[model samples]
Target: MNLYAIVLLVIVLTLLTVSLARLGKVKTKADYLVAGRSLPAFVLIFTLLSSWIGSGSLLGGAENAYKHGFAALWQGGGGWAGLLLIYFIAPRARKFAQFTIPDLLEARYNQTARLLGVIAILFTYTAVVSYQFVGGGDILHLIFPTVITADLGKYIIAAFVIVFTAIAGMASVAYMDVAIGLLATFTMLIALPILAHHAGGWSAIRTALPASHFQVLGDFSFVQALELFLPTCLLLLGNQSMYQKFFSAKSEKDATRAVVGWIIGTVILETVIVAIAVVGSVLFPTGEVHERPREILAYVGLHGFNGSAALQLLGALLMGAIFAKIISTANNWLFSPATNLVNDIYIRYISPEASNKKILAISRLMVVLLGVWALYQSQHIDSVLKKSLYAYTIYSAALTPVILAAFFWKRVTAAAAVTSIAAGTVITIFWDTPFIHHNVPAVVSDRDAIFPALIASVLSLAIVSLFTTPPTPSQLKPFSEA
Candidate 1:
């Protein structure tokens, strides 16, 4: 193996070792599901950072940057906007102290809302997990092309993530994320100045690339920018993985403090990631990464520092961080849906009397099964950007409306909540399906799914709530306290 490959392998193996070390702590469902609600503010900060900055930002967001230059900050900006709002809600979420978003769903609305919320989460989180697998496979293929094609690499990635996730559950995922979080943060921070120097400083980059990249909107029209912005905003507002992290916090203070760090870290890291990709665009302007720009950051890690042995070592570790991050993200998104299945569906309905031992075993089984399913879907989706947005839209449309209303609008009846969830879920699924495309008007079919799905969901919620009876004071009690 080459020097870079050897280094990359060692980094990945070390992360796996970290995961295995946490296995003994996950002896109960509570520990496996929410790390026993013992995570302090510092741990929550990094885990939250690691989870959000995964394949979506590394791959999908980078691809957007490669194409659009700085204007691609629209994607990251969406998250920033959401985080501002999240600061106010994090304490409320921690104070509620639930295991999953679905737990909130059932508490605020009804059992039906909880079940539908699970369905939406399963679809969205699994799609997110699949692209993480695709991203990991891209890194593996970039490093070891002759031995492992991207197609085969997907299976390898799926197996490793599933095993690692199933082994330690949330406990391992959170702590391992702290290391990965710091590694990615410091590595990217260090790499950017070197990359900028290699690109001949800011002036050379400005001269070489199209001026559009530096523009606020880039090549995207207003509607196109909104298409990217809405899904990310919506997703961040209602992201189950994010809420789970908040729930895992040791106290309401911890959860609230974590969001403050999270806001600053997210803004810095996301912009840096885009900067890395923009510099890469100047270095290697055309090729497979140009064609499949999702791999642009990884491509740079392998080739950006070509001459110095020291720089090459840093580059290899950077590449390894990218690879390990894909694994961390997949573990998180995959483990999230499995938590929904076990904590929501299995324990809530199927067998309420089950032991923590059985729940722990079943959570692992669910992780394996969902990992296989996500692997199957990864074969069909062609673009990480498409999959990322599609997955984001599903959660945003189906769940964000009701979730925010639960925390803010006490008058929202269960009828409206249920209707909104159904509307959003159905509209998103059908808007992009082949059958819907064949039937809908050309203009409607050509538009982004987020507009239709989000509008349908929010409208149904508002109109239905107006027509239905307001929720009782008993139902309104949660928001009053919040």
Candidate 2:
């Protein structure tokens, strides 16, 4: 993990990514962002899995598990629920041929709805990118401590992400993800079992840790689990990153196959990572573990398998794979919102006549700007899961219900859509504000932000749609035909 090795690995990966992106001949707007909507089943699945898991799943989920034991599984389970739900929604989403979530909203509702959706997306997705930078900085600092200072590490990571993302957008993201995902999957499958065996087996793990760490229900009450479950479900309902993957698929069959693959891949990989965290908890068995859960995977690399050089090499491979996952997720998430902003919002509304070449140039520039902003924000955030939850809640509350209504309920009018999105987002922000903090009970306050946001959004959608005039026959025709 010397400075030269780290730099060489990063340089090689970047060049490979850029080279693949150049192969695609991005002459049009579609090619630049969504790979001209031609991603095949395997590429789509890997990109979806890699993008969703990101730094949040690795660092954030592991940190939660280290601190609260088995309750952390709830976070990963939310994704499982989401993927199951997506099984039915994926085909339709692809049928729409929309570039972003806001594009779908704009097509079904109105420009006002699109604008509101964009606002929420930018806020939340930027926060998501911030956590990625934090994760990247952590990885860099861990591997090259003496040569790569923390400040320099953040800049290096930001530069790497920005450059990779700006080159041919989703084309680059998807192709690079194929390689990164395969590497990550193989490395995890190989390393985790070895790490566990070295840690002395299931019996030793159970003996070393408290009984609650293995509990299926965790320490949280049924009601508390419900609170956690609802937000994650809602967030996944209209996750823009997931939808983008659907749009990128080469065919309807590819989209469906990819989602099925995503479910299996996500479940298996997430379970392994969770097991790694649990094993680390058993081996370490101390309060200090909470502060450095990011190192749990790294710790395995450093100490998990001694004696055999083969085991140690497997450990190092796992570490590199984990690092790749973190970086890939960051690249995709950071790029998606900016893609939305540039194509869906900026090109559509700000300057409809802007040429594709100019739009492409601006999209690249935005990646750099976003990377710098994320790096600055990452300095203040300590918990990746909390930041991710906050971002997920904003998108879930404001857009999920409205997006679902677009597919199922023809009565959902533009006004209702706008109001629901506005009310949900505004209320959630207010709830988190200092003005209401003193009055809300600790139990309610401690729960995920999505609860209140979902309630407000759903109620507004139902109430407003019920009271107001429904869409005209023309508007209902498309949905009715489906």
Candidate 3:
């Protein structure tokens, strides 16, 4: 193969080997699920960063910037807003340590709430993982067009991520994130100035694209921006993966410290990513990138690095890092639902007395099964932006409301939580369905699922809780005291 492809392939192999080496350490259920609750601030920082900045930001958000420019920050801006809230909640999350989000739901509400929590996570996380396959496949096609087509690349991506994640569990996922986090940070920071220079500076970018590209709203309406912001914000606020990572933290301080670092890194890197896409807009233009704009960053990488440019090697490194980011995301998202399957369903309901070895075996099996399922979904929903938003809305609308109530409101009753979840989940599923969508008032039907679903969820929580009895003191103790 080409030297660039070879070099990047080597980097991928190295990361995989490092992850595989961590296998010996994953001996218990805690080790597999939460890294034995041993992650420190530094490790937590990178893992959170790497996990958050995935195909959605790299491919989908970049595509938005490719067309809309800086205004696309609304997508990542939502997470940034959510991160501020996460900083306050991190310590409490650590104090309330658990293996999965359903565990928290069951504790705060009831068994039905827990089962619904698991169902919401399965649907949302699998959708999240699907797009990662699409992104990785796009990058692979760029590197090895002759040998591995994009469709083929997707299958390979799913297989590798499945096995790699199954091998070492959270320990490898957390620590391997260290390398990915550093590489992505350095690559994006370095690539921007150089790519801007290559694109003939900021003035050139301004002249090449629409003026709206520079505006806060960019040609999008306020509602459109809100559509992007709400899902990401809600997802971050209720993200099981983040809480899981917090549970993995060695202490509350470590978890809290990590959030500060994660927020700073997210803001900078997301801005830099959009900047890269905007600059790529200047180089590749509308007709080219628009056809598959999500590949803008990959196109920029291939062009910037493969030739006689001064930053050629660094460009390839950045490209490799981007690819690694995709794989890392796939690993993270795919691993999450598997955790839910094993912890919430398998162990909790199927085999509570199952031994550690038996549990770990089933955990790996779940990873493979979920990865395959995600891959299947990716094949059907090829549009990354649509899939990403759809997935984000499901989790944001369904889980975030009840999850926040668990910590913030003792008046939230079990019946209220259960009803809220069912409302949110059902609304999100049928918001775009042809039969239901066709019959609704255009005002409600025309909007994205976030508004309708979130409104229904919140209203159900408030009104239903008013009618039902409040949560008992014991349920409020862990949340209030911690």
Residue-wise lDDT of candidate 1 within 1-482, one digit each (tens)?
79778977787788788888888777888899999999999999988888888888999999999989988889889999999999999999988888899899888888999999999999999999999999999999999989999999999999989998999888899999888888888899999999999999999999999999999999999888888888998899999999999889999999999999999999999999999999999998987777889999999999998888999988998898888788888989999999999999999999999998999999999999999999999999798988999999999999999999999987788899899999998888888778888999978888979998999899999999899998888777776797
RMSD (CA, Å), candidate 1 to true, equals 1.1
Cα misplacement distance, residue 267 of candidate 2 (Å): 0.5
For model 3, the superposed segments whose C-alpha errors exceed 4 Å read: 286-288, 306-310
At residue 155, candidate 1 shows an lDDT of: 92
lDDT of 2 at 30: 83
The residue-level lDDT of candidate 1 at 265 comes to 92
lDDT of 3 by residue, 1-482 (tens): 66568767887788788887888888999999999999999999999999999999999999999989999999999999999999999999999998899999999899999999999999999999999999999989888888899899999888889989999999999998999999989988988998898888999889988999999999999999999999999999999999999999999999999999999999999999999999998888856566999999988888865556456778788888899888888888889889999998988888999999999999999999988899899889757988899999999999999999998888999999999999999999888888766799888788889998999999999999999988888888888887
lDDT for each residue of candidate 2 in 1-482, tens digit (9 for 90 to 100): 54325543864566465646565587787887778999999899899988988877788877767656767788788889988989988888887777898888877888899899988887777788888877777666766768776567777877878877777788888888887788888878887676677679988877877777778667777776665566567777788988888888887789989989999999998888888888877667654345577666655555566666676566656667777787788788788888877977678878999998899888888888877777778787867777878777887889999999999998888989999999878877677776666788877776667777788888889988999998888776655553
**lDDT (C-alpha) at residue 154 in model 2:** 70
- Over 4 Å off, model 1: none
* Of candidates 3 and 2, the better by TM-score: 3
Q: Whole-model Cα lDDT per candidate?
A: 0.91, 0.78, 0.91
Error of 3 at 332 (Å): 0.8
